[model samples]
Each structure stands twice: as C-alpha cells, then as structure tokens.
Target: MSGSRGIVGEKWSQKILWICAIGSAISLYLVGVERQTQNRFQKMADDLDDIDYSEKSGGDGT
Candidate 1:
C-alpha cells in the first residue's frame, strides 16, 4: 500500500513538473516575440526621424 502511494505521488509530481516546464517555455516564446516586435517598431520610428520632411515639402511652401 505504501509503495503504491509513493508511486502515485511520483507520477503526479512528474506531471506537474512537465506542465510547469511547458508553461515556462511558452512564456519565454511570447516574451521573445514581443521584444522583436518592439525592436522593429523602434527601428521604423528611427528611420522616420532620419527623413528630411522639410526638404520634401519644398522649403516651407516657398
């Protein structure tokens, strides 16, 4: 009886550990995706800042 209970407990613990590991992996993946998106937006904003909009407007409408 005691041996059976120990085996059951171990199985439950292993299942819980697997669940936690999967959750952690998913969380990491989401964080990486968010970071990449933020970096892309930051780069786009920087490129826009580098543009000479004033020159393109023909020197303040002549």
Candidate 2:
C-alpha cells in the first residue's frame, strides 16, 4: 500500500512539473510577441516624429 501511494505521488508530481513547464513556455512566448509588437509601434512613432509636419501645411493656424 505504501509503495503504491509513493508511485501515485510521483506520477502526480511529474504531471504538475509538466504543467508548470508548459505554462512557463507559453508565458515566455507571449512576452516575446509583446516585446516585438512594442518595438514595431515604437519604430512607427519614431518615423512619424521624423516627418516635418510643419512643412506639409502653412505655419499659420489657417
């Protein structure tokens, strides 16, 4: 009986470890995608800032 319980406990612990590993992998993937999206947006904003908006239209509020 004790040996059976030890085996069961070991199986459950292995399952738990696998679950944690998969969760960590998914979290890391999401973080990587988020960082890539953020960098893309930041580059777009920088490009917009580089444009001379003042030259496109009259300087006056007209």
The candidate that wins on lDDT is 1
Give a tens-digit lDDT track for model 2, residues 1-62: 99999999999999999999999999999999999999999999876655645446644322
CA lDDT of every candidate: 0.88, 0.86
Which regions in candidate 2 have their CA more than 4 angstroms from the true location? 53-62
**Candidate no. 1 TM-score:** 0.80
lDDT at residue 23 of model 2 (Cα atoms): 100
Clashes of 1: 0
Q: What is the lDDT of residue 59 in candidate 1?
A: 57
**What's the C-alpha lDDT at position 46 in model 1?**
74
Lowest lDDT 10-mer window, candidate 2? 53-62
Model 2 clash number: 0
